[model samples]
Target: MVKLIALYRHPEDQESFDKHYEQVHTPLVEKMPGLKKLEVTRIQGAPMGGEAKYYLEAAMYFADRAALDAAMSSPEGKASAKDLMGFAGSLVTMMIGEVSREG
Candidate 1:
């Protein structure tokens, strides 16, 4: 399996970002092929107790890299790309994501 993790650095007004993610982004990605599971989390607390970095994190599970690539290249994928700009306009940083998983 492959797990894609996206680190979202959001605007200070998190409610707006969360709303966009739920109402717009999440659904677009959820339709991608090969996705076996999906999860989204709002980051909270700094274990190091300095500054909390990152606003939210999302994970998408795929059966394999090929499957993931197909999804990322599909119509849903194109829409996902367009949707990103909505939050990215307000974001400090947005990470593409790293994929990993255990068999």
Candidate 2:
């Protein structure tokens, strides 16, 4: 599997960011053609007892890199990308990678 991971820095307004993310951004992301699964996490303090650098993290899974690329090039993907610029651009860092799981 391949995944697109998004790390969100602390925003100026957490409430507003949460609202928009839940209400608008998530729906847009769900529209991607090859999206297999979506996972989100709210970061708390670091294990060492300091504040976390990231406020949130999201992972979007796909079958492979090709599927991921296709999804990102689709219309829904374009819309999601454009929407990110409106609110989360400066606060976000994104990456794509293969996933490994072991039981």
Q: For each candidate in the order shown, give its overall lDDT on alpha carbons.
A: 0.74, 0.96
Q: Per-residue lDDT of 48-67 in model 2, one digit per residue for the tens?
A: 99999999999999999999
RMSD of 2: 0.9
For candidate 1, lDDT tens digit of each residue in 1-103? Answer: 7767777774777687778888888899888877888887877868987556777777787777788788889998778867887566556343434455354
Return the lDDT, model 1, position 37. 87
Best TM-score goes to which candidate? 2
At residue 103, candidate 2 shows an lDDT of 39
- Residue pairs with backbone atoms closer than 3 Å in model 2 (clashes): none
Q: How close is candidate 1 to the true structure, as a TM-score?
A: 0.81
Local distance difference test, candidate 2:
0.96
The segments of candidate 1 whose C-alpha lies over 4 angstroms from its true place after superposition are 89-103
Give lDDT: candidate 1, residue 23. Answer: 89
- Among these predictions, the greatest lDDT belongs to 2
